[model samples]
Target: MSVQAQGREIRILALGDSLVAGYGLARGEGFVAQLEAALRARGIPARVLDGGVSGDTTAGGLARLDWALAETPDAAIVALGGNDGLRAIDPAATYANLDAILTRLAARNIPVLLAGMLAPPNLGAEYGAAFRDAYERLARAHDVVFYPFFLDGVAAEPALNQPDGIHPNARGVAVMVERILPAVERLIEKARS
Candidate 1:
């Protein structure tokens, strides 16, 4: 922890779509809640703001970023692009929107943990390749922490996901939190520093 941040609450903004919104999960079972709990468990005084919206795309995330910034977060987690991939939105558009989001956050001096997403398999190999690589590109360009594939251990697992197979169940959320906790810790350190 930075000397200046010794005793204050660390606010983290979580921006994304249904996965971040926890479409089917209950309030405490969502990603943000679980992540907050995990942070606290590690003795980190942090609050994660839920900026997720069901059905939101990268364009939507960009549109709402200003409002989200009103929270004045110390750090951010950008987890968008899932809906864009699901809808087969243009890779260039997705990349542009994400770049804008990261750029705006950087402008505010907020550290970020970019949660990545992959293109839906049915979107074709060429489209998938383009979509899958945008997050890494953005992470390198912006010099932010990156968690490639937000659904790492949970996606495509019949037991880990809800019946819709798109959203993770409570257990899946737990798994996600477990996998991303280290990165989040790093993000908090960045914020504190």
Candidate 2:
């Protein structure tokens, strides 16, 4: 699909933290760009709005939701909670923040695709379990599309991730886009409906 024909310029807000901000990579090499290219390749006319803020936690996302939604995206991809996990914040708080985001989006009649995050194992088994479960609970409760783990195929692999061992490299982001595209496509379809 040509750039102009992607769904009447359907707005897609990618709200998240450093990874979405493309921390160490050039602008075009980031997740949003790659995801946009992937969507266009699939003939989905869409534009990805960068709502990422470096160092943003779940609370930060909630704080900024009104401003982000002011852009009037047709759909939203909520990719937060990573920094919360890194800081080992309470899983319940994380869940509450995400639930609020999802609830607000639902109230707006905007489709959401929740991108889940996994707490680092160093945080301990109990913490890890609770953190992972929060995503599951929110997804089920909100009935939104859920990508179980954002960094599923790229997280720890030195070849796929950057030297920081946190964010994924361009190739890794491509892998992530491929894995999550189906769910995101469904979100777009829902939004269009």
Candidate 3:
């Protein structure tokens, strides 16, 4: 709160997939937009750049890290890996890609919030364990903020998702923004310090 008095906007890179991209929602209804609105509502001078690509996997996110970094964020949110899980890619490869992404950001001294994704249950328990474990490791190794399960309150709830049942609608996005706000605020505080 009162972050605006610091005299510059806190730029946060929302790097991830359709969840961060706000796939089916209208322009302002997406994650970045709603998050920015929430930050502003709390009197924090911040802007959340949307680095989400509709179908991006962890590999895709690693591939485009430079492009997203072009915004020169003060802090970042890593929300990738959903596409990788959906595609049932090797968890090892997914872990490597995410590791690279986190490594790069760490090298640059940018604080990050690593948003975790759980593998679909149908993927089998072993796959799910390996997939979800990567986030924890990365968070500990890189010393980043970790918010487990990006779709925590919205996942599998028909009322919170769009017709496809994969992406959250506006209401669901609101829930996400609400739940993730504290972590983002902590990210902002870290940036200022």
How many Å off is the CA of 158 in candidate 3?
A: 0.6
Candidate 2 lDDT at 85 equals 92
Q: Regarding TM-score, does 1 or 2 come out ahead?
A: 1
* TM-score, every prediction: 0.96, 0.95, 0.96
Prediction 1 TM-score vs. true: 0.96
Candidate 3, which ten residues in sequence have the lowest lDDT sum? Answer: 1-10
Report the error of model 2 at residue 181, Å: 0.7
The pairs that clash in candidate 3 are none
lDDT for model 3:
0.92
Q: Per-residue lDDT of 1-193 in model 2, one digit per residue for the tens?
A: 3333444768899999998898888889998999999888777778999999999999999999999999999999999999999999999999999999999999999989999999999999999999999999999999998899988889889998888999888888888889898888888877876
lDDT value, candidate 1, whole model: 0.92
Model 1 per-residue lDDT at 62 = 100
Candidate 3 RMSD computed on C-alpha atoms after optimal superposition onto the true structure: 1.3
Candidate 3 Cα deviation (angstroms), residue 126: 1.0
lDDT of 1 by residue, 100-182 (tens): 99999999999999999999888889999999888889999999999999999999999999999999999999999999988
Local distance difference test, per candidate? 0.92, 0.91, 0.92
